[model samples]
Target: MSCAEESGRIMVGQEAPDFEADAFVKGGFKKIKLSDYRGKWVVLCFYPGDFTFV
Candidate 1:
């Protein structure tokens, strides 16, 4: 199967589509975007809630 079909709408080695949304940062909510951290290492975490082990 193609990468898109196997991985929903995203594929490896491809740039993540840009997006803007409110995110919690340093005890405050602020607008954030994927492009905001260009050229830097980013670790994205998606979970049901905090303190849950992977």
Candidate 2:
């Protein structure tokens, strides 16, 4: 089966849908986009805010 058929959504070698959001970085907020990091290694981490039990 093709990658999309197996995944039911995105697939290998497929471009991610575009999106924009405000991010807190370097002690400030900035607008960012997924397309901004094309051709670069990106690590996305999701976690609860500090002072809260996991």
RMSD of each: 7.0, 8.0
Q: Which window of ten consecutive residues has the lowest lDDT sum in model 2?
A: 1-10
Q: Per model, state how many residue pairs clash.
A: 0, 0
Tens digit of per-residue lDDT, candidate 2, span 1-54: 112223346667976655677788999988877668988977665578978775
The true-structure Cα RMSD of candidate 1 reads 7.0
In candidate 2, position 38 carries an lDDT of 88
- Candidate 1 deviant stretches above 4 angstroms: 1-8, 50-54
TM-score against truth, every candidate: 0.63, 0.56
- Model 1 scores a C-alpha lDDT of 0.70
- Enumerate residue pairs that collide in model 1: none
Residue 15, model 2, lDDT: 64
Query: How many pairs of residues collide in model 1?
Result: 0
